[model samples]
Target: MAGVILPRFYGCYNCRKRVALHDDIVNKDFVAGYRKRAYLFSHVMNVEAGNKTDRRLLSGVHMVADVHCGDCGVVLGWRYEKVYQEAQKYKESKTVLAKYKIVKLDYW
Candidate 1:
């Protein structure tokens, strides 16, 4: 019961279509001493990444690809794959959204 995760519905801001669920994002176990990456808890959808493209996080770590709106092709955020230093093997995909670019409707 300690590790069970619940699903959350999030949509692409531009498309307004369901893209991803909460469980798709990864969270790691607590580790001490080493620097930890920034954690953002939000609804994410329609993200893309590539080996050729590069994005940087606040921690100065390079992310593999830019997260874009799948339907509208808007730059929504970035994806930090295995090379993110904090997380490995695309276990943790990261993204950031500008306030004006994203909105969450709480129907719950």
Candidate 2:
């Protein structure tokens, strides 16, 4: 976290939806398929929208939903709603963008 960091972009699961900028990534380890990585950006270009679900996960208690590519409907990661677990409650307002579901775009 030092000098002149350039920006990097990432796309959605199926479509070329620019979902994340380099700095928007919350995890230190920017490894693909990183566990429960969240981002502030969603599909940049046109990809469909307003598709969300309120569902639970793990023990089928905490409410979670897959944040998919609206155009292609590929599962991104998840959005936490109501978490039953004590640790997961903090993620209630965050969206986890699946690393494997996105492709890193080259810097222009």
Q: Which one is best on lDDT?
A: 2
Candidate 1: worst-modelled 10 consecutive residues by lDDT:
30-39
- Candidate 2 lDDT over residue span 1-108, tens digit each: 579767787887577777667665554332224245445342233333333555544435656555667667777666555666786565565565656677887853
Write one digit per residue (lDDT tens) for candidate 1, span 15-92.
Answer: 655545545344423221234332232346555543535444444555446567777777654555535465443434
- Give the Cα-based TM-score of candidate 1 against the true structure: 0.49
Q: Which is the leading candidate under TM-score?
A: 2
How does candidate 2 score on lDDT? 0.57
Give the Cα lDDT of each candidate.
Answer: 0.48, 0.57
Instruction: Provide the TM-score for each candidate, comma-separated.
Output: 0.49, 0.58
Give the count of colliding residue pairs in each prediction.
1, 1
Regions of candidate 1 where Cα sits further than 4 Å from its true position: 1-7, 23-45, 82-100, 105-108
